[model samples]
Target chain A: MPKPAPHIDILPDVPLRLNRCHEACGPGADAFAFTLAARLNGPVMWISESWTPAQLNPVGYSQYADPAQLLMARTKDQTDTLAVAEEALRAHAVRLVVTELTQPISLLAGRRLQLAAETGQTTALCLIPQGMGSNAADTRWRCTPVFHQADSTQARWEIIKNKAGTLSAWDVRWDEKTRHMLVVPPAGNRPGLADASG
Target chain B: MRPVDGPFALTLHEANTDRIYCLNDPAEGQGLSQGMGLADARAFCPDLQSRPADPAADARFLRILARWAKRYCPWVGLDGRDGLALDITGAAHLYGGEAALLEDLHARLTRAGLQVRSGLADTKGAAWAIAHYARGVAPPGQTRNHIAKLPVPALRLPEDTVTALQRLGLRTVDDILTLPRATLTRRFGTDLLMRLDQALGDQPEEVSPLPDPPSFAAQMSLPEPIGLAADVMAGTERLLAQVCTRLTQQEAGARALLLTLRRVDQASQQVELRLARPLRDAARILPLFERGVSAVDAGFGIDQLRLEATQVERLPARQLSPLHAAHQDKLHDLITRIGSRIGLDNVHRYLPADSHIPERSYTTAVAAYSDPSGAWVTLRPRPIRLFPPEPIAATGHRPPRHFRWRRMSLSTARITGPERIAPEWWLQDDSWRSGLRDYWQVDTRQGRRLWMYHTPQTPGWYVQGEFA
Candidate 1:
């Protein structure tokens, strides 16, 4: 019998296979991707080139995990930005790597990241604002803000692209008190939402 | 200037009274001595010419002269407040003989408008005593016999201690040496015995030399002002050459350098540059200053330029590499490669600071130089993306029902807090000038969870951060 592939539970019964490259995009994508980092072990390499007025506060990140576990690299231009990400993943020194790119990824660049991840057995999660383009990524998740009752406001997480052809959507809320993900059952996710395509 | 042969003295004010600090030979001839009250000196000699003494300027001038004395010997140290001590053990042959060296030093300093008196001996204390009491070179190994004839004060005792010795009918160093060692120590304390022993060559004394080349600074004073950028670059390069040469002799390198330019208008500007590694190569260090030097505003015109290495570290010579990257330090290589494009300070790590203020809670440290510390202190819920507080239009101490931020109208959907956090009274913070704040975590109807605070003292509301 063949052994099952290694994976991590992003939510209850929601298993995302590891050792591959994936993309998280849209409004609340940072929180969505940080949830994955909170569950993984070992040091994390995070690369970005954005200069927004506000920065990612480590205090706010304590609700998920210790921000000290992150190795942040602020690279120069687009080329150096992606080059660091590719090199870090290829090193396999870290278990998981995260990158926030300003522009959308092309199929060629996405394939290169995927091969590097496979060679080092590391998970590469790219946090992009643009929607999924023509890329050879294993999965593409889009998160959008939705108005709910109270503190645990539900953010809609829809797996718009799955290479395995498994498509689904769910309302995810983080229970801050327990440090756990509270996913409401799949609801009717509008098709026109992913149609915008960045 | 007063005539060289006139009666003159320098006075210093102390204990609410002015006293004579130094006196010329002519003033001494008139019975005016050091430590005599200025008023008493005037009563004793009506022709005395006196001026206020400046000890700070005199000390600075001595330090400069110490650097110049390095030409006679490699080890030159400042002795007391008004003397320079040079150890010329193996260097006397350069001037033919011991007496020849002293004659040359006295002649050179006399030509430079200075009163020079020197004594060469085997011991520092003996040499000091010989110079002030009897000026000449003591024959080698005859330090004990030579200084035995000097007075008790020549042993460098305190004024009261010397007076006590004189009251005992002891006027010469031989008088104090003839008494039993135990009896002398009991009568005058340990200081008198130690000075006696040091001058007799029985105890060794160390003369720590001054820092080599007067503390790693190179300066150029132009005859006329130069306003062009090229001229400033040339001056900076020349200073770098001198500073790097001194750094090599010390087996160290500069980590931070300050290049200061003084304009003819009396205004000055500085260009500060810090490096990731201890660097001595002028070629590598010069280009780093090019960016800051280009922005120099040479106001009316710059007349003087000085380059000082503010921070230096020991850096032994390493084998030159063709790419400067063949070394096996991976962490250093990573920082250098990224630090070249973005500055080295840009690569940083965030560490937790013990403070209740939102901005002061976490401190940023450059990752290349510092290590990240332990856990983040999270007692209450905090936002992930925080910035300076953005004001919102609202009233009362309650969360705003509707508000606008960055052109988006946000309506409060759910509120979870009124966590009251007052300003640290001990700290003067401009942001918390309104006193205390009631912070609220509001999940807006538009899918944004904002960390907003309301100030009761000022009756205002502001949004500080987002949970996303």
Candidate 2:
């Protein structure tokens, strides 16, 4: 068994173990990672594959975090993207690093990134379209756009596994005016959500 | 000692006539002069043996001789097609003096079977004229007096200009110098005076020397074959140290280093490392080589190693780089380490561009080459991921309509008002050719907020972005 590393937090409830890698897979995974990046201080690095046919819109990213603090590394291959993300984390040049992968990486590659992130004290997030089934990551997140009831605009982030053992799930909304993620109370009548288009 | 038993001449066809381009000393003595017709030269010397001239071979030979003359001085230029120009200003003292230097050059070339003429002067024009006409070293500051008696052709003017001056009896530099300066310019243009001024040291004539290109490479062979990765890395480190020392001596930094390994079976393997910036530090370079060193397979015990700085740039010492130097170094190191895996060009940042269109609001600039500038100010609601528009199948233009996207069909639970975006009339965009768009931020029942647009001109709906 590999050694356990301390978890780090980008937001309040999302305490992702540091030196270890966590992942958010399936639909809306990148958006969940971007929400965490908004809370991180210092520089951030993002890695994506070149032929993915999708573009990152900085206009929406600016609403979450300062795009100026973000550095992007686009690789030709999926393996190279993860490898570059590992090196970026190992360099400890940034506080957080995000990687956009077409598919989930293997447990060995994930563990390699975990060790590298631990060495540099960087939190790495691998956002893939498919879930990481039975991987060695610290946690596996599934954050999707959900409303409390009708006409509500909030996101539901559910943690399928947490090595650090935090909350099971949390509901939050991106507050545009304050530029922070406001956690909605789970116990009661919900705060009526504003129009998501704003 | 001659290839021909008698006088020899090399003639070339020029201006529709076979003219004598060059001749040996014996041919000159037999009145078979340069530019003379072959028949006329044969009449002058019945035993004349001649062949065609090769100007291209002569020019190549001249360049070779110029390179050889670099032993006298680092600055050497080709004077026309036949002469050599040596700028032995400070270099002459090494061979005793200017006259001694000329004598040594002339003696060494003469021993090589060349009838070489030597000259020593302060300027290229004076030296070339002396080598052709005077054939000896002339005293400094006495160029005007020395070349005053030489023919006007020694000034290196066009043949027509020289002939025109000769027809007017301005046969020597002294004749032209003695005339009114304005009258000379009026008669022969500035070229004649420019040459005379260059000879008399009134105008500076720079000798653009042929530079010997510098090579940054090092190679070493092992005493015995060792197939271990440690042994290969050890060899690589040693080679890198040697190359770095040489690079330090030249004040240069390597942007890319190529390390090649040779095995006992005569197979070669290469590991290349590219950097985001020029680097020369051996300690900093050793770790970078570590990443690529393991990838090379040491087939059948490697026996030789070579490291070469394939791309290099100048990196001078900085005096006031003390502040934030450590911070900048770590960032650069990170960029380089990541850049090596993904290409250096792939590492970049998105800088905000002033545009009303959602897609054109930001431009990705390679991080190493640019500075972080411009604050991203989002004017309206935009999605996090904005790919090219994928057509959506809908019944009506209003909200609550069902559409299939990415293998999923979902109905809109909530819809916002259509925010109209018109095409910039001055710009040409093929995507916006369908005309003005009425965008609707729709929250689907399937827990997805999609940015949908209706092209008013075509009256079709399409999904473009995700607000998730």
Candidate 3:
């Protein structure tokens, strides 16, 4: 008799949110990603062409359940850059990988990264805004800023993504003076991702 | 120590890159403003002193302030150009409530001859806003209301952002408060919202609490900077002794070290060393530094010497074996003696590579600090010497039995295997440009066994390694 394969909870295939970097996303995209990484607790990676210390200047790694590791390629356009990033992800047991690239990813590279993420049950958030072509992406997100009509001191972050079920589009109001993010009006009562109806 | 109310403060100012500009007046008649022209300032006050800014001096002063600030609160950070931020949350009660805390701080700073403005709030963002905007200083309870009256600059928005807001006909905090939140984000970006959020205490902003002094660092401040190699060695010896004592006290050993030399001319020279194993004795550490210091070309005198143990491990407290004890002592002695003479970094140990690539099987890491030999416990069947990629004149798919290596023509006596090794498809390594390689162990006529490989895709053979 053949040995039975171990029952595993494979990660479900989720749509990839694609956007052209620097266009749909601004300079603050890196900061936003970093903040999310902190909130997520563990398993986040930031991949980019040109990296400055400012991008990685969050709370130190010792604070996390797993130490935060930053990996880089000597050159951006080099084909081996993705490989290096993959190695880092495997080595560090990263849960999420964020990339900032000037060019769009190839279909093969996207498939490879997706497979790795599925195998590891990791989430990869690729920031590609307008202008760059899609590479077999699972989903696409368009992030834009919006201010509140009642109070100018607050602003709203509108996240429009294709794969977010009924919650594909949502807005969260943020106070400019307090640096606080608040849900506006009726939507404010719902929890994060609560509106997503699969 | 002087009373907290009356600590002496010294202010040093510099003009451009040269000249010293200092004002000893504690009564606010220094005749200088940030944007005032140099010529005009001089004309405004004839006795005004001017000197070029010495950033090194400013850094040194900050370090001093850091040490002194510990007397009040352990958490202190240098806040921009000429300010320090202290998190006096829990520590304030020691001096009494907020009022007494400020009084104590004021007294100490005044005595130190430093001008200070302090603001207390629930958040660092709020505190920062209050400190820069409110009159005198935002009293603790009314921090938010007080900040509202201050100019938009108090929000700490970038100059361009502030200018854009002004152009939008939004003059005050009240004016912006009436506008819609979505409108602000669409026009200004999230940063505007973030700043506003910070002011209203909606988000938490943490001050990186100053860390307690570590036991692994050794520092020496010279009366005058020393430029010669021997002078540097003398300072290094003192620092090593201190660090060794610290390591011994903690029952820990250092495996990696950084030797920092700050030049009198404001330049810095650094040397790093890694060891095969952790070591605590100064005798072992001093020698490695001798070669290291000589390598540092001190363009100017070195004013400070800082030695830091970058990596450390717990030292096992076990009795030394009679046989290995002497050997261990001798090995350590030799390492230290050689370090003193040739410098520490020149010595190295082999560390196992994390990759499967033959050329990457081992790498050179700093001796004395890394477990290089320990990384590879079981030895694989590897050649004693591996040559860098060498070109051969072979044209066929099969590796030629006779090939030239380093101007010598050698014929193969015995050949073993075409071990097919494929390049990682996902990765593009330049060395892998030859694509699939078929490695072979060939015994040559010169009694020299060689490791040769033929790239089937590229159709060529190359000598990769030699056997002992």
Candidate 4:
């Protein structure tokens, strides 16, 4: 019998890419990235292009990850931004390396980044625009924001591709009280909706 | 022979007249001296080959020579436009003795294609006189006798004073020393007596050494120039080891280090590394210089490598648990690597500022120099991202039912509050020019949430941030 495939987790020493479904889905992906980084052991290195205007606000970012633990680098172009991310990944001191690119990265470049992350045992997250070409990542995800009730912090995530080729989707919301991401169940399984006035 | 193997002189033109500034040995043998009128000099040797003198180039060469003199002594001062004085008082012992030291210096400089003359004396006046007129060492107690026979010009006095003294039949220092002190003072206006006393060691004179150059540096000069990156890395490692050892002995750490590579072609390239914290471990500091070493273009080859700790700080002692210490080390290493790649100024940490205005509530500070302290005041809800209050096309002082921001039209479905934040009057902030602001959290129909405020001072509404 053939050996079972190795289970893959979004663990340390793995490179994971989270591609947004659309431009409006960036905030949701960023929230997931921060939540993932919060579980790591070291600081997070965030590299962005100089032309990118979105900046991480400490006040809101402090809820998921310590703002002091976020080290940011703004590069002049996508090439430098990716290079900085690779270098940060190679450094074992950083637990996570997050890079945002306006353009798609080549397969070879993605492989190099994956190798660096694996060697250093660092978790790498690449945030790219929707419809970008394929990359050599252990897991590729597409995150989108879900419209919920007023004042609800809900986000939807779809595992577009995985190492085992398994695809799945989940609706999640950031629980402010617990400071954790809670997976929202299907409507039928939810408490109030399952049984009415029983 | 007139054109091929003849006398040559360098002429300088000043005040509409040409003068002989320098001449070859053959011209000197023909009695053509420096400062002689060109017409007269040509009369002496009609076959003279004369070229214009370049004083600027000569001064530049002199300055270069002064820099080279630093190899022998830490304190090398320019004696004049054509001379360098090295204070080798304590440093002479390293070369066996004062006489051997002078001989070595003279031989090395002469081999470098310079006409060298050296003198050792107890005073600056005596040294200047002996170096120019006598060209030998003047023993400490015998400085007076050594300079007695030298001409009055050796005293470094004005040419008019020398001429006036010569007319009085006092050509040598001995003649002036033998004269009555009061008479010498009255006749020469104390200048002659002062020079006499200074040369005899009766009066003290201080030699102002060149302002101390940067310290806390180690350098290695390779015998054979190497062009390989490995060689540069090895050289850097050796230099860093030496410098870090010294830093440890001094109980200090370096915050900034500069590594300089002197190429074989006399070009120097430098790589600067700034650390987020003061560090002295050579093992940790060596890797920070690896990328910089590879980036250097060792055209021809590199002959010397120098590492200088330009900025230093006192590292305070801290007690840490093993786990905590390891984590701190990891953080420091990460910060240092990122700082080296993207400059330390780009890396910053946010500190809570003591203010109520949303924009003024936090300040960005350089991570290397600041520590995050103080509690964050979270009395009111703040947006995850705060931007310059962008004016929204809203209707009135109350929350807008419909508005356009960043080319997106949104209809408000629910509103939370009017949190009033008063401006700090003492601080002059351009953004806070409007006195009072009433902030409201609004959920829009397009699945968007924004923090909009109405300013009573300006009577307008603006959207400042978005909640994620």
Q: What is the interface RMSD of each candidate, in Å?
A: 3.3, 1.7, 26.5, 2.3
lDDT of 2 by residue, B84-130 (tens): 78888889789998878878887887888788776777778988888
Model 4 spans with C-alpha error above 4 angstroms: A1-25, A193-198, B1-214, B316-321
- Best model per TM-score: 2
Taking all chains together, each candidate's TM-score versus the true structure is 0.65, 0.71, 0.35, 0.64
| Model 1 residue pairs with clashes | A60-B383
CA RMSD per model (angstroms): 10.7, 10.3, 30.5, 13.1
Clashes of 3: 74
Comparison by TM-score, 1 against 3, better one: 1
For residues B357-441, write the lDDT of model 1, one tens digit per residue: 7888888777767766877878887887787899988998789889898899988889888999989989888989997899999
Docking class of 4: acceptable
Say which prediction, candidate 1 or candidate 3, comes out ahead on lDDT.
Answer: 1
Worst 10 residues of 4 chain B by lDDT: B206-215
DockQ ranking, high to low: 2, 1, 4, 3
Every candidate's lDDT: 0.82, 0.81, 0.58, 0.77
The clash number for model 2 is: 4
lDDT of 3 by residue, B96-158 (tens): 777777777778889987866777776677677667665244556665676666667777899
Worst 10-residue lDDT window, candidate 1 chain B: B324-333
Selected candidate, larger DockQ, 3 vs 4: 4
Q: Give the TM-score of candidate 1.
A: 0.65
